[model samples]
Target: MKYQFPENFWWGSAASGPQTEGAADVDGRKPSIWDYWYEIEPGRFFNGVGPKNTSNFYYQYKEDIALMKETGHNSFRTSIQWSRLIPDGIGEVNPKAVEFYNNVIDEMLKQGVEPFMNLYHFDMPLSMQEKGGFESREVIEAYVTFAETCFKLFGDRVKYWFTFNEPIVPVEAGYLYDMHYPNVVDFKRAAQVAFGTTLAHAKAVKAYHALNLDGKIGIILNLTPSYPRSQNPADLRAAHIADLFFNRSFLDPVTRGEFPSDLVEILRERDFLPNYEPEDLEIIKENTVDILGVNYYQPRRVKAKENMPHPDAPFMPEHLFDNYEMPFRKMNPYRGWEIYEQAIYDIAINLRDNYGNIPFFISENGMGVEGEERYRNSDGFIEDTYRIEFIESHLKWLHKAIAEGANCHGYHLWTFMDCWSWANAYKNRYGFVEVNLDENYKRTVKASGKWFKTLTSQNGF
Candidate 1:
């Protein structure tokens, strides 16, 4: 059987500034929280490898853009580091950053690949962090100003704009899980950060609309479908609550113009509600996203908790439900993430049924593998047959959802080339083209890269 994608599909991958563009202290680029954190606690990062050791996209974007064209990329996504653009987070803009971004955008356009620009991707400026990051309303105002600056400068060429990539990550990592910067385990602070992030998103959207730019503005949310462990009512309720906290927490406000009332009630009942101004609610209600970007890598399988959390312990979402690892579920052994391809179709159907079928694309979806170098063939290319299979499985399900009237526009891989991750560094590679850091940052087209080229050129497998 043959499966074909829609015409003019956005066939490419997503990358970020901090993860890819490694000129940490150059070109008047001030420190982001990652840089500052790495400076303070070098041992926190994987193998003591920091953000400065990235793919060097800042210097290699032209070559990378050429590779994007080689891989049959009709469109590509990357973020502009806020700290690099406005070094102090507000007021004076850096001309070098503007020149670099303009060159990158123009180069992509020249190569016949459309540029999809995102404003933020977990890189908070050090100045913003000093002002309390997303937990402070002052930082939110500053973020809105930054967004407006992006619009005024580059919105003319970049048609697809995303306010943030995986906005829930900071709330989970920084506030609740202690995995990211300013690591803390406070439920109230998590809720406050989440609310402020969404409010800032809405304010950015409002600012974009006010300018009446030709481009469309939206957000990239990593939506992990919550699956119940059993058919019991308690299990179902547990899944529902998990969905509310993880998925609908951002989805509802961006797509439907309001937060889930049930979620709010639970927060209020627990006295964990975030501080909010009356005008913030109106701002969220008035400015919803014009489109959405969904990043699906895994599903959350949860079962109702049999024991309640200790009153003395700090509050966390996991206290309400226990994660269930199915005995026979397929898994990505390298990353320890469940491989559930059907979740892609489920997400599409969800959007069609509940989100006015608003136009969207798969912003990030791919398999990550550790020690991918072992798969390198004698021909100097990595034979990533597993990645090819992984992508095809998901694409088939995505195709089914689109056939069933889901308004999905296209699919973009998690990344273009192997790049540095926050704490993980470059341990796991999730790229069609493998980056050989030891060999002068050489870019080699993997077997999956060749396969993707064919897939994009043919519109499908």
Candidate 2:
């Protein structure tokens, strides 16, 4: 094989309980923020579809695990919905939820697929949100308790654990942009939420280690490399600030146990620093991650701010940098996201040189097409040659990075099957297996799925 990966490299895909498991209100599973938000404002989601109409993994884990093996997945990543497990967020456990997750894990093991369990994936219980979500120190402690409970319940069988997936997303989506629940658009509150989430992650890491479990615990971060349009000092500075806000804010603390000094100084100068006890800093400093999960989709093309906002306007990251559209850049026509394969290699090199060469993997990387059925052939399988090309191009760069000693361990696509995304809600299809929504959500392996099985069997393409 020309593009060979390391031996025993993890080849799988990732999904989340809230996104895949469809029993939103069944078996003691309470409403998550996604459910509550959809209830009040269904029009915000695509086609007015809500969280209730997911892929139904809750009722079909056995079949799903079988499909996972058929698609050549040696390992898989999925999150444990906090709302489903605890329901009330900080009290008695849900027996049904425990049984459901236990069965899912056991079935994966039975099928020879390793399970990489993540504790949280943007699925906050409604009760926790009512208590100020991650913004409140009380809620942070509650999240830690939930993490500890998960460890006690499922630690022995699950060898890979993650504290959170894309911890910065809620801070940006919910607090800054109003894309998620509680829709607050205050920069100060967003800063508080981000800080509190880091504190919660540290507490969870502390709790996991205190139990002396044999598993590795880490946090998944979506690290978009910031590329300046021009190397001018101003443009470079703008890119630096963008990186500080989006990437380094979570990456540095989880790996290095501290925030970037430049970011801290900038926030301090603006009087936008989040409220934190002195002890909180100690916890963050003491407990860092054991590994890392990097989810790279594209690079950020930025330039210096062209026109300043009104002096009295609310603060935002855009005030310091402006997004620049690089001419002739590759893009995913359906999703409107840039297709930058080399960004994966850039991220690996950055981690190798700057972040202490910590072991990491591509936790989430895949294309989301708007209408994939158009590519279906007469034989019923979607050809999806573009999807295969997308993965192949990215893997070539990843192979180069690993050959140069980048310390990358695995590559897991963003999803295993076509799942119901949060707000997009199946607007884009991104899976090797097609989920026929019109046909009782039937599962059919696509052309790319067959190709993947061969790739995994050979350990390369």
Whole-model Cα lDDT per candidate? 0.94, 0.93
lDDT of 2 by residue, 114-161 (tens): 999999899999999999999887899999999999999999999899
Query: In terms of TM-score, how similar is model 2 to the real structure?
Result: 0.99
Candidate 2: count the clashes: 0
Q: How many residue pairs collide in each prediction?
A: 0, 0
lDDT of 2: 0.93
Runs of candidate 2 exceeding 4 Å displacement: none
Q: Give the per-residue lDDT of model 1 (tens digit) for 197-238.
A: 999999999999999889899999999999999999999999
Tell me each candidate's TM-score. Answer: 0.99, 0.99
Which regions in candidate 1 have their CA more than 4 angstroms from the true location?
none
| Residue 458 Cα positional deviation in candidate 2, in Å, after optimal superposition | 1.1
- True-structure lDDT of candidate 1: 0.94
Lowest lDDT 10-mer window, candidate 1? Answer: 52-61
